[model samples]
Target: MARCFSKLTQTSVRIEVGGGRSFDCPMLPVSAIDEFDGIREMLGSVDKPETLREVFRRLREMAARVLPEEYAPGLARFTLDKLIELVAYLIYGDDDDQPAGGQAPADAEDDLYEAKKK
Candidate 1:
C-alpha cells in the first residue's frame, strides 16, 4: 500500500550532542512535515514575523516526546542554542554552523544546501 510504503521511509536518526547527551529522533511524519513547511513558508511571506517561538517550541515538544528516557534530564538543561542545534542535527545530520575539519575559519563554506538544489 502507498500509505505503508511512505511510512517505511521514516526512521529514527541518532545524534550525539557532546557532553554525553544524545537522542534518537524519528523523521517527521508526513503531516508534521506539511505543517513544518507551511509554517516556514508563511513566515517567509510575512513582513513582521511572530510566533517564531511557538514554532520552535512545538518542535521541541514533539522532539521531547520521542527522546529516549536516558536523555530526558539533558533536555531540561538545554539552552535555546543547544535545542536548535539538536533540532538541526536531527533533521540534517550535521550542524552547518560548525566548521569542518582542516578548513580555515574564513575558508569554511556554508553551501551544502545550495549544492543539493542543483
Candidate 2:
C-alpha cells in the first residue's frame, strides 16, 4: 500500500540572544547544507576539537546570510557560546525554551498513564 506524506512546514524563529538582542532567522533548509562548501566542510569536521572556532564561525556566517540586515550588529556582539547555542537551534530545530534533545519531561510518562485511566 502507498502512503501519502504531507509537506513539512518551515518557519522562521526569532532568537533572543539577551541584553535586548534578537535575530529573525529561518530554519536552515536541508538543501543549504549541500549548497555551501563551508557548511559541508564544517559538518565533516565535527569530531575535530581543534577546529571548533572555525566551525562556529562558518555557522555564524551562514546564519548571517539568512538573517535580516538589522541584526548584523547583534550577531557581531554574540560570544562563542551564544553562537554554538544558535547553531544547535539551527541544526536541531530545538528552541531554547524546550528541553535539550527534545525529550519530554521525566513525569510526562506518568501523566500519560494517568490520562489513559480517566
Candidate 3:
C-alpha cells in the first residue's frame, strides 16, 4: 500500500510498501525532525493501529510454521499489540509488561498429561 500526503504549509509526504513486506519511503528533511518527533509522540499513545495488524499477522504466520503446534495455538491468539510489544522488547531490550506469546513451556507438558487422564 502507498499513501501520499501534502498540506498547505508542510512538505509532501510519501509512504509506500512493496510486496506487503517492506517499506519504501522518501527520507524526511533534516528540518522536519521536530515535526517527525511530534508525529511519533502523538502516534505512540494510540492503541495498536490497524496499519500494524497486517504486519503482525504475517509475523505470526511465519512463527507458526517454525513453532511447535502446542505453542502455535497460543501464539495465534495474540493481538497485534502484544506482538508489537514482544518485538520491541526483543529488539530494544525494553521491558514490556505483556507476556510473550506461545504456550507456557512447562504448562504444555502438564496439559498433555491432563488430557490423557481425561
lDDT tens digits, residue span 1-118, model 2:
4332211433445566588665556766766545355655665767777677666667677667666677655766677667656655654454332232343333444465579889
Model 3 residue pairs with clashes: none
lDDT of 1 by residue, 1-118 (tens): 1111222333455555588664446644444555555655654565543565565565576556666666656765666556656654455442222222333222322243346668
lDDT for model 3: 0.41
A best-first ranking of the candidates according to their lDDT comes to 2, 1, 3
By how many angstroms RMSD does model 2 differ from the true structure?
Answer: 9.2
Model 3: CA > 4 A from native: 1-53, 62-69, 94-118
lDDT on C-alpha atoms for all candidate structures: 0.50, 0.57, 0.41
Q: lDDT of model 2 at residue 30?
A: 65
**Highest TM-score, which number?**
2
